[model samples]
Target: MLSGWEFIPFLTDYLGGDIHAPQEQFWFLNNFSDLVTSSFQNVCGGDVLNGRSLGILLIITLFVGWLFVKNDATNLLIYVLGVTLALCSTTFIDWTSLSHNELIMNTIGNIQFPFRLVPYAGLFLSVIASFVICNIIDGITSNNYKQILVIISFVLISVCGYFGTVQPALDRITQNVSEKYLKKTESKQTIPDDVVIDKYNYNAIFDYLTQTGETDYYSEKAYNNATSIINNIVYVNGKESKLIAEYKPNKIIYMIHAQKGDKIDLPVIAYKLTSVSDNGKKVKFNQSKRGTVEILARTNVNRIEVSYKPIVLYYVMMFIALLSWFGVIFYQVKNVKNRLIY
Candidate 1:
């Protein structure tokens, strides 16, 4: 959101309450009202001109206007004009009061703030300004001195623009990394194989798992109880029975070496779509308190499989999307061939 005076850097410090410093209730009330009021304010106050970045904007506007008048370049003119109008309407219009005009208000409300339009204004102005520069160069007589001067000016402007935008972005990234990651404290506790101790502290573990294409299941209760279930085997009374398993998003395979009535608690979050089977026969599964799938081992049962069957509608939609993409590719190829031949 904007505060109607965002263009003035000093006003931003006063308008948006500082994130680090403690503030009074009145400070919050004043700034909060400014945010909401700017979204619906129609008239620009006397201070508005002083707060606007109008110098560069004026130069771009003059170039675009010259193109519009000299060549009557309708395509470029219409685009620039449309973006200009959008920028003005967003900044100055009383959008919240236009409830009667549902379509316009709804569309503008989705954007949330008028200041976001400034980027598009800059982009369109840059494109039209480039065209105007090219036109000026074309109109000049074949003078080496004039041509070289124009080229040098363009290069300097480009270099200045690049450093002005990119250096600040790079500095901000360095500052954030130093504050969040470099200053974090180290931990010494040994985490269990089945447990993710502190998710925020072990974010890199989740990131690695995701990158390696493993399902990173997150259930507050389910993951916490996974360690307890495996440690204490309640149903089976046999020798040291160990269970080996392979996990998948929709399927799981387990090799259990346990006696009849022995149960193995899987480390996956239990869902209604999940089904369990043992040695080709379907078996009933119970969800533990932590929401993990619990399977009881039967006599001579060595292999167990748990699968999640996707719905029919999912496959149907995927098929339709695939066909639509193929149709689009075919159409584009045909159009390109036709254009080349003609």
Candidate 2:
């Protein structure tokens, strides 16, 4: 992407030696695009909470006992606030119940969480300091139920740290490149007669998402998802059926249109239909002998891509958020010059 900066020169030459043309067309991005890219990055950027690996919980427990075991109102207040924020920012909880048996995971997936809308989820990073003041418990202090809970809480933190910060940035970068270079294009207006419009059947795709799953999703409200799609197939002369399917499809369908005066052989139908995946191939049957033929209105296809990614960067980001927390603490101490509660 950095090398693509040279394209500006080529564009400038093409635009009649106007040097600024290259900068405008190829190199320089609009202010709005830059702003959006910077501001709304948390949902699409690096993971912020993968710090679960840092063992901050271990150090925190030790420090709390050393500094505030005797009694410190400031410490207690900070600890309580940090605990509340950590729980709010992380963890998986039932936002609501769906159907009779399903519990919806709503906490982490929620967009309304603080710092969830910016780079690395942009927390003030004060949660740790808050805990430092109230560092009353941890595996080091009490390894019973409290220890387990603390570890579990960190797990949630890791999840939020990963998704809100790192994952979103990766997604955004990939999408940016694709949009910049490999933009999606609508096919020609007129689909070939032999072309099967199987993808045109969108309703069927949604049906599969709802009915085909043996395991219910995090939310029973999956069909109405923003990323979800609806498929519908209006088969000509009732030759095919309509299906409302999920955005992600698992079934393959095709609209077959046999040419006039062709022998509609069974083997040919199977052979020809198989090739639909690679090209716009059609199976032609004998139109005259009660032979069936039709143009397919595709409504659905299997999910060809995914929005989530692996955990490599998520791990790195965990480090950054963790360190960032300390940075925030030092900044506060240096600036405020007072050891008081938030």
Candidate 3:
């Protein structure tokens, strides 16, 4: 990504302040109880609290405290990491407050949202929870209380999860399906049937539009444009022209019916690494006012191809990542086998 500095936005810095954490989400003594009570809010998308779920979470949290008393090396490390990451996820200084400090606004502001670190915090907490459960089960033969506690923990987790996250999420899905797909509304009818309803289509990030003097990337025109459509219609000299676009995941081929010397504006973004070939010969392209690629028809070209060619370093890093994954899996499997044999 660093190699293709011209194509990728926000490589060196990001100045998007609107995406930062809000004042309401800041951690404070008065709202500290929300750490447990807001479990339902995280899942179901509302601030509504479930008393039973809150009680279950609070019990689990107190159970986590027992790990500190036990003082196992691995458990202690996991506990410290989890607590530190959780605190990092909270907004110590609100977005508005951070705007005053230029140093913080430039450094920490690049993260976009501090809450994005919450997943890492949750991952460590989950590992600790699993360790605690396994330890309790292993000690159950010596102490009957361990067995009782294990049973209670399982029961409470299941019940609370069903009411707090599972059931509410299911309800939300049903509501969305009915409102979005099932219900026949005038607004929904205007949407084209060919438009692909995928995660990429709804990408909220508009760092690409930053070059176009657009500050609020969330605006409708900034993200959604003619290029976003599956069947991208070509425009020649600001007029609609007959063209057939064959779209693929990484490449696009446009068969345009244009004369020589016609300036063609293709419905695709002009990235530095984007290679354009007219007929069989490679041709240079320029960025139009709207940041779309503009190609000049040196000859009456029927076929034009566009594809991304990433730097060699990207492939090298990808290969290293695959090797690392294999190495980790092999070590883990070997360790498990050794334990079993012993």
Winning model by lDDT: 3
TM-score of 2: 0.21
Q: Lowest summed-lDDT stretch of 10 residues in model 3?
A: 204-213
Report how far residue 213 has shifted in candidate 1, in Å: 13
The TM-score of predicted model 1 comes to 0.36
TM accuracy, model 3: 0.58
Worst ten in a row by lDDT for model 2: 20-29
lDDT of each: 0.49, 0.32, 0.55
**Runs with alpha carbons beyond 4 Å of true place in candidate 3:** 1-35, 40-78, 91-95, 141-178, 182-248, 251-255, 277-284, 287-291, 298-305
**What would the per-residue lDDT of candidate 3 be over residues 1-342, giving only the tens digit for each residue?**
223434333322123412222222222221224545564344544434322122333236434645443668877777677666655655433555665677876666545555555567666766776677666676665444555566678889767775765555455445545244322222212342212233443322211232222322322321345343223457788886545466566777888777898998886666656688899788999866555678998676568888876666556656666777788899977875665455
Error of 3 at 113 (Å): 2.4
Ranking by lDDT: 3, 1, 2
Considering only N, C-alpha and C atoms within 3 Å, which residue pairs clash in candidate 3? none
Candidate 1 vs 3: which has more lDDT: 3
Deviation from native of the Cα of residue 21 in model 2, angstroms:
42
Model 1, residue 300: what's the lDDT? 51
What lDDT tens digits, residue by residue, belong to model 2 across residues 299-321?
23311111122234444555666
TM-score of every model versus the real structure: 0.36, 0.21, 0.58
